[model samples]
Target: MRENSFEHYYTQKPSSSLETREVTIRLKNGNVYRFISPSGAFSFGKVDKASRLLVEYAEVEENDRVLDLGCGYGLIGITIKKEHPDITLFMSDINERALKYAKINARDNNITAEMRQGHLYEPWQGYEFDVILCNPPMAAGKKVWQEIVNKAPSFLPSGGKLEIVAFHNKGGSRLEKTMKEVFGNVRTTIKSGGIRVYVSLKF
Candidate 1:
């Protein structure tokens, strides 16, 4: 495929060269995870800072049904399952290479998760989640990211939450505004690195 293009990771069948690497991420809670990332996935060589922050702060309960939208190599969802095994986790992405590694990572970690391949909420049409986590693909542009923010409510029940991380200069402000407009309430937790975690509750 196009080398390092934004659309490379969103392709259903990625044509990028098959190169793989293994990465270990140590979570804030001292839990460690190992993942296999291939060339055609986002953050292929390491765990992304935004995704790391999302997993660190995204609130999840023991029995919460969680959906990791656009889960690249299953970092967010797999980490959650590792911490709270009782929570049901679902991971979806459009990249086949990412999905393949996600399944492998989950299996290697001995974590149970449903991995589906589809764009944003399409594969999860009939499913509902108690918590949704995303580190949206900002390179995909505002319309794509905003669609993720806007469509989250329909998949969530009352009291359910949607949490996302974005760079302040890279659509975080717009995301906050969209969350406020869509969910009626939005809370932000900011980091010194200009990364903002936006949380919205469906009520």
Candidate 2:
């Protein structure tokens, strides 16, 4: 595995040495969560800025069926579930190490969520969600992110929303364009520090 390769984080069986660490993130909703992060997962040290931005801007409703696609260490889904306990949350990731930590985080937080290990949308076939949250794997390249934007509408019902966070210079514009083409409308909910949160409704 190349150093800094995002694909390494997507591996089903990671060969990297395990270095477990704890991370506490303060959310926009004024709630703080502590999670255990292993070395092989994405953002092992702390919650990444894009995920923070996504959690800040994305809307989660009570009783909403939510999917946190590419959930790394369960930050986005766990935080949302923490705030909206009535919602049904499903978290999926390709990385086994990330999924293990996500499970640990969910248990530690007393949050009930379905955690699955698979590529985007694979584990949720024939299922749909009222809202989908993602801090896309930008390091995995545009093809992966574009697939996420393209297939999102199929997994969402009418009026369902898909929210994503990406850096402005690094595929953000392209993702925004693809989102517009797919969802018919794309809105920038938040943009700061070179990162933008783009949201689209499946109307």
Candidate 3:
């Protein structure tokens, strides 16, 4: 199960031998960013399509407090911060190795963000965010992703947005339904390459 599933990227401590590589991503807006991705982290060679879609489509505003839930190597949050410097950015991930690389990537890219290592939203229990963005761990099973959807409202103020990305055929449809169930409203704002970005506004 460990070898087949995405458990390695979702664990607090990954068992894989440490290996690192530098990845560069150029966004649609022509912004180029670099990140240090380690072995056992998700999307090690480049930013995955789902995450890139989330980064591009999610609505961020000036001075908004943004939480990048399940951030892997700081792709979404770090990129958003670079794009909108005024927004306060927070990033968290269950995987310690991912968090470590996220921190390094943040520094390397000259982006400032608060990073925490914990499962789901535990690291930010009492905090509220204006926007929460995620590229969920689909292979980690339903419970993990369900927790993210079910508990997101508690950490968001009324009218706050929660955005997540996945392949429509590969668990994205279920995620859209779950978000609608939790938040009472949901919409797909972006779709390309079989990936979809689902957005919900908390009431």
Candidate 4:
């Protein structure tokens, strides 16, 4: 169904306004991109802080299949492909507008990637990845957050890293426990910047 407006496609479903705005992100490499922003989507005006860090430190290897969960506008996926040039990318988002922009940015950046619109992994069922880079939507509340984490592990291969970054106050500690349940080890990197990146391997 074509959504009327971005009433947080994740939360409510649709809005009346249907207004579109321009959201620009300045990447770490000084590359700037502007995309049509749908109202009521997460971080509708700017690049989210936690996601900024995810793209900042995202690492890729040749031919690695990378998944960008909650990939708003394809920033993480596009950036990774630009830097690495050989990694495969798959972008998924709940917001239809976000997914639209992801495709737009991918075209603008000349990156070939598979775009999937689904709640977490519904689109990639039975598919495995070498890396999963996600800035999860913790603001959606606990149940939703757990849904994302619980389902993310099945997509990762053994020794593959599930790179997740989130706002420090938004149940960051709690996520570590969930990570441990799926993966034996959960390492936190950059815990001092009001954000944390939890790197977990599915053993």
Of 2 and 3, the candidate ahead on TM-score is: 3
Any residue pairs clashing in model 3, and if so which?
none
Write candidate 2's Cα lDDT for 66-178 as tens digits.
Answer: 99999978988998888789999999999988999899999999999988999899999999999999988877877899899999999999989999999989889999999
lDDT of 3 by residue, 54-171 (tens): 8888899999999999898898999899999999999999889999999998898888899999989999978999999999888877898899999999999998999998999988
| Error of model 4, residue 142, in angstroms | 1.6
TM-score of each: 0.95, 0.96, 0.96, 0.86
Q: What is the Cα-based lDDT of residue 105 in candidate 1? A: 90
Total clashing pairs for each candidate: 0, 0, 0, 0
Please give, for residues 1-203, the per-residue lDDT of candidate 1 as tens digits.
Answer: 33346788878888888999988889767778889889988888888888888888888998999999999899888988888889999999999889998999998999888889999999999889999999998878889898998899999999999999999887788888989999999998657498989999999
Error of 1 at 85 (Å): 1.2
Q: What is the lDDT of residue 61 in candidate 4?
A: 82
**What lDDT score goes with residue 30 in model 2?**
74
Between candidates 3 and 4, the TM-score winner? 3
- Candidate 4 error regions (>4 Å): 1-13, 16-24, 27-35
Runs off by more than 4 Å, candidate 3: 1-5
Model 2 segments more than 4 A misplaced = 1-3
